[model samples]
Target: MTRKRPLKQAFALLVVLSIFMVGFRLIPFDEPRISLGNYTIEDGFQLRVIASESLLKAPVSMDFDDKGRMWVVEMIGYMPNLEGIGEEEPTGKISILEDADKDGVADHAKVFLDKLVLPRGVAHVYGGLLYIDGPKLWFVEIKNDRPGKKTLVDPVYAEGGNVEHSSNGLMMNIDNWIYNANYNFRYQLKNGKWLKEPTSARGQWGITKDNFGRLYYNNNSTNLQGDYVLPNKIIRNKYFKPSIAENKRLGANRVYPIHQTSVNRGYQSGVLDEKGFLKDVTAACGPLVYRGGIFPESYNQNAFVCVPEANLIKRNVLHYKGLQITASQAIEGKEFIASTDEGFRPVNLFNGPDGAMYVVDMHRGIIQHKAYISQYLTEQLAGKKLDTLQNAGRILKVTSKTIKPNPIPDLSKASSSQLVALLSHSNGWLRDRAQQLLIQKKDRSVIHQLIKLTSLTNSFSTAIHALYVLDGLNALSFESLSALVNQSKNPETIAHAVGLLERFSARQHVAKMKAISTQLLAQNNETIDLYLSMSLSPWLNLSEATFLPVLSEIEKKHASQGIFQEAITSGLGGKEEVYLTSMNPTDLLKKDLTTAITNRQKKELNPIFVLEKNSVDNRTKGLKLFRSICATCHGADGKGIQDLAPPLKGSEYIDGSMKRLASIILHGVSGPIHVNGKLYQLNNEMPALINNKEISDQDIADIIRFTQNAFAKAGKGISADDVKKMRDKKPSGSGIFTEKQLLESDFEK
Candidate 1:
């Protein structure tokens, strides 16, 4: 090859880039411009284009203000100058669109800010617009009919790398916390003081919440990853990540990633097969939990996602088992919305003002960027003639055909009490706006009324929102907390109360939480117990002696029951060890519960039966014992009978923490309980089996071995020595063992 000059090569590249940009700008958007008529949707719904074409270029995300003005984020630089340039080119813009004359479609549009490079997330905050423009976040101060003054906000996601998958789904939740998925930073801005907390990265993209204030998150390839036990517990614990422990199973192929659709070329493309499916998800993005009004009541709080690779929006029915999530398809044989148009790419989804879900379609011909472009994908695009429909894009709302959308709220001038009333509104947008304004105004004037709303309102969501607003204003007093725990039975609300008490750490407040926790624990409320443990885990800050009663009650159950058994047992190593350790509890904690239990066992169990060679076939003998003893309560198969007995099958206690399970069998159990997410009253308490004579250690081991083999399919059989080691601690004199005691046995160790 003739050696080309370095300068000449550089010139050729620039010329090619210039031609590509020119072609992108000149590409025709079909005449009569694409509208709602261009697409088809599911039954019981109609698609209406709110804004299109010139008003929106490559719109990816959107949000609305109190005035119902729609703010749309457009990534014009997406796919990088139509695949001929670098990724970070500062080509993103925020468009403010409005139907000034009250028409349904947007008739007025203005470029609020046009300097953003790959701006991905947008939300209405404090009467202004907050958006993520790369790694840095920005806020634009807006006054109607004028250009907004954009200011550098928090230094959240420093804004580099692949723009396609970055932090997104910016939102303020019921707890008055702002979060973005794929990022660990959480924000709580109170009167200009940003209280930042490092949290778990929810997922790769979308974020949402249910009526109970539990957050749910999603990413592009992963299905779903939240249903947090509390509003923001994961943030405090630092245990969540992009690859969360819990996930919703969407029918997706499990590959690394599908699209290197931006100039950031870190992802692979040859990973895809000939048929071109995204493996597990074609791209599960923009997850929304419908908390809107326009849809039928049946659709409320149901999750919807944009599976772009499949050219469809899917509806998922979410089932929560305690803290875990189980999602099933709400619509069978079809998605919530799908289209034949090859360029129909539903990139992001949101539930907006009029109680309708809006889908943002990038509407591009060549979506996959040039850097990682592969031969197979190139051929696939050529076959579909989907190379460059560059200028077309849309924001369309999907709503019921018969039910008219509620008129948007006009809270720009509402009084404090009026805003408080809006907290109970059916629309998530309205509730969020109401809380945002209340925080901004910080009107101490409504504190009393807000307190009343929290206590008197029938709507649990409203009650919780009211308390959150009170907290925002620093107006949450001891009285407000007293009302929250007393007025609501909802676990999420109780969790928030426990969290607040923990943060404040007042002796009186901790005492109050302990009191409430005592009652809730009696009912086997897992949410409250979990929250209480999280609050108390910091140090021996609050004297471990204070919770002795609650601790003593749960000691027999599971350690997860909020009774820290290892801490308790190690403390019991003797009065001197306890006295020495009060000043340095972390040191005492080093003495594992197993060692403590072993020490205590030699002193506790009377007439322990050493296993004999002729002790009987465990499965056969254990089954006979189970039929005569446990069958009445735990059922024939250990699946549990009803309110009277709890199931042993499928319990984490059975397959997990073998020591905990063996202890419960040896000592018997009492108090309220949680088994596989269901709560039981235990009206007929599980009778203690080890009367020192009726059930021997060998018999106990055999029974458990049989129960494990019969009920827990994934169980490893319990050995005779395992039962005696757990039996070292004597049973309580009367009543039954609590969940905490079983967990304290250190079986999970």
Candidate 2:
């Protein structure tokens, strides 16, 4: 009996050991564990991990639905390792994160959509979810967290660009239009149909808007770039690209990292400080104008920028004057949020429904795209074993220490009247979401309440939201707008009302508008005058004699301000010749205005030629390559990014000789080169493409054809054989060609 008992005990022990080994094998070996204590935020603020690995991975962008649930875009395939192998695999996904327990942390994650390739942007708009997957923008109705009735909003939405330079930030503005960065188009869904229109090409990564509806974005180097004026205001004459208002750099490129930073170009002189910290922003992106009311009043409207390469977030205080906006760094030699943890990559920022600033941390060591990867960066990444950090991401919530965040409200279930009432909410996210819902529902039942809300002079933001909502619903009437124009003491309200009054600029309302214009001219407010000048086009179309004098007066009063002159020019539209002919030639602004008007008219008459079908195909392919590869330094418009490449549009190198251009493309050019008479002394040499096996000779020819057609006088055909000859005649010692050498080369023959 004793021997039998011992045998049974031995069998039981074996079973227990087997169970232990099996359970241990199920543990995740590769998942990286992050410590929240590694972060260092500014005083009076706290950062907490709301979601992390196992719940989400490699989140680049996110949007909140009407229910306050977060829909995150996971770019899982982005730089999975140092080699970036298998990046083309469809591993990206859009996930719905919910804090069902309400403990201020996201514990439940559901894959809303999967099998996406490098999905970059997402927005909840027009009773559907809009998302960008690679080159296409798609709209899918979300039925019970599942996709239904998928629609292609745009096929070439963000085509040809690698993830670094692709269009992102699917932000829905208060003007009822969807805008993106790195692309030159805006989208809208009006009455069950999609409308797409050309807008000024904006920043490289994330995009945002202020409470007043002016867009704000940034590139890789500049900290902040925003429009001084509102949307579609200055772009009236497509030929005249105004430089004062749109895409203006608002802040300096200075950055302050708390620790020694790891940057892609740290080896480059002036990129790193003496202390080995990032001296300036090398990867400044994802700018957000904070309107979350949870912070102190001084924090309102301040711009917070994400600098992932330095592992920091910067704060810029925005100063608003009469008609200008400028931003300065909030603290000297410090950052808003900094971390010693090199893996903390804050790629994007957002305003949460609960009045907190939510940060999307990609949590990967390699933030630089493979296309732009430098040898110095590759070595630095390898030495630190940083390239091994992948498949980890987190969503962090930042809130003020003194103020507690309120519970997020589920506006998806709110009635129309209830939604209208929330338009005045102190939280900008709530107000924006409320207005969006009201417009999407198209419920005119609350139009009367919205009209009443527009009259609330005490709540300027609420009044603005109400006015735009009314405009979106097509409920705005001439009577209500004119009343607001005449009675509202707020300059911003009056400006918006005047701009909206253009919809009512008919012969019957001419006299009333004329009277209102005269009354507004008497006020002498620059803000009101600017919008008045913009809104007078239709009235000028009807009675140029009466409205032209009003525009002239505005021009003469604010003649020193270029924005006002542009506004007046925008108001003239097709009648620029009449205004110029009537104005005195001796007027100080007349010469510049006449030049602008003449250039615009010239462009309108001589439009770009339509290429042949075959030529068009090649040009299209070239454009894709240019945007993906060259647009990083040379802007998408060929107008060169500041501190990077020189403008390619009117360069002598582009227009001089086709063979010289081809040689420069085959073997790159180093500059102190004069491009359009401006000397560009760039820090880094343009890397030679002769050794890049991925780019074929035909690809080089296509690029040449594109630059010639788009920027030169006409397209000059350069066959693949021509490019091959240029490649074969590689300069001795295999170095980039200097401008002197290029100018003296026989390739021009």
Candidate 3:
């Protein structure tokens, strides 16, 4: 429904309170205030104030509707109080803005959804705007190009634990999966059922994928990270262990500092250090992998990450070695879009219709949260403040000479065939919207043609879109999926097909699916093999030999890999040659193809992809070792068993150099133990977990690194040499070292 609230509603909520919810209050005002930012750009680019600070206030996110008009989310009341509380009031708004004159600036604006609470993320999808407002996730349907009634689709449980780090970015991937940041459990209504993929913990606040479906994201801190190697084959993330490592800072190759800006609040960024050395990236948001038609072809898949604290957008060029992933700077010294407007806070980035980059500028006095407020920020805000412009925001468009956006398409009443053609459109969003609309229509008349597009289309992405559309409509068949698998050369197709095809497994299409899995067995994707084994084994009458390949791959994968080990513990059964359940792989199968797969995996994959892949094998081996040995004492969760062993978490002693840390694992701890400022004495003394003959140096290193990844909260991983040094310096023994003996060593100091 349309909100008829007057403009005063945006300005009237400035009253101050003593609560710690709001960090800043709106300045006393009687009239609307606007602060049109100085839109400046570097060479080869043109900047436009699409909707200046006048029309859009606190525009944190935006997406184009079918008609091409932009729908914007205004967090008008966010951060005004101590808590940034939007507690049951019209503190935020979703508005529709139109560039009716075909000019850069929007001439009209109207309230779409009023009275929102910290509404951080939104996208034009399915039928309306999908948004996350802290605890509630909603869909506000658009009818006849206007906002209709809203329905609560799910609850975003990001109400606590740093709301800024909560589920924020809502993006629809090319494969038809709408992913979110941080929120592990999400609901999507599909085929009259709620399909859910819930993880254990949380991840970043912004998420985007490259052309091949490799995800890229960042938190309020951690810069750029996601699949360096081909990720696990099945659904693996049960929890998001936050990367607090100051050293594990991974980003573009080029190391550039914050660009020109005036409102210099924020502490020295985590992406760089005191000596101008790169440390990590903090406040990294709006992760965008450029996939539009208008820009230069050379910039096709370049990743643009917004560093609002730096007042710049970084351009990261993607490079692949063997299969290892690397993102280096596109430029040497400058940012993609550096501005002097310190108040120009870009919270989100979008690849728009005109083949241009859209920046959502929350032009306010403060961007950092109260809890994370640094001393530098407090002093800066005190001097260089935008107190009068607390409700100001802008949507900026960046384009080049070769790019131009077309008029918006009115697809609400488009024909089935008309919608089908968009499957091959150059713009990914167009293809996604078309597929969504066709599925929503659910007309059997278009089924044959939709199936035809999947076969006839030459573009792999277009074909995949058609495949998922059919799946979304719950009309995908074994034949259609089989055709996709047979025709497409991209391994990603096989992976996507497996996900879509598994929906039929519940219907007991065992043989049809078994044939498909039998073919995929030859194609050695760990994730694909894992999925096929799990899906087909429970239904098909396949022999244990069928899963041997997957089981071998699982055996070689890192311990932090997947549900395989857990499956082996819970469902697997066998006397000598064991398997997960009906389809678990045999031990003999691991031996037969173990060395062969490892050899082929190194050479056949990209030349640069070997190291990262090998590390996975090493880590997995260590996990197996850890379970058989260390898990008995440190406990599976690493919190440690009561009295039996002290907690491994928050152990400052463990944070010392690798030599000392490795010595503890190799020789074991003894006497009184103080970790994270607490003392504990176990009943039994520590014992050496490793036997030098059985465990390799790489195995010990991988185990230590895995623990560091899990319990130590470290980014800098140790090498085998680091572990080797500990063994060489202090030979392993059954006797435990006293607390003073471990601490007094000058090795770490």
TM-score of model 1 (CA atoms):
0.66
lDDT tens digits, residue span 1-749, model 3:
98765653432332222211343222222222343344445567776677765677888888787676788988776666322333335678777776543435676576677677778788777776888675777877776555678777765345544446556777776655566766555446665444555422224656666655556676656556665322222222111111221112346433354443322222334434555433334577777877776677777777788777666677887776433456778777767776656777777888776557788888776776543443334444656654444877888777876566644577776788988888787776677778888877887687787777665534327767777788777777766777776665555556667666655554445545556656676666655544444343333224445434444455455234333443222112221134333334445333322333344445442122221111124444555566667778887556688888887667775556777777777777775788788888778887864566777778788777656544554433678877776765553354556787777765543
Comparing 2 and 3 on lDDT, the stronger one:
2
Question: Order of candidates by lDDT, top first?
Answer: 2, 1, 3
Q: Which candidate, 1 or 3, would have the higher TM-score against the true structure?
A: 1
- Name the lDDT value of residue 281 in candidate 2: 89
Q: Local error of candidate 1 at 207, Å?
A: 1.8
Q: Give every collision pair in model 2.
A: none
Misplaced by over 4 Å in model 2 are 1-34, 458-460, 585-588, 604-749
Displacement of residue 622 (Cα, Å) in model 1 is 61
Q: Which model scores highest in TM-score? A: 2
- Per-residue C-alpha lDDT of model 1 across residues 180-247, encoded as one tens digit per residue: 77665667656665566655446666788777766677765565556445444432222112122223
TM-score of each: 0.66, 0.80, 0.65
lDDT of model 2, residue 143: 82
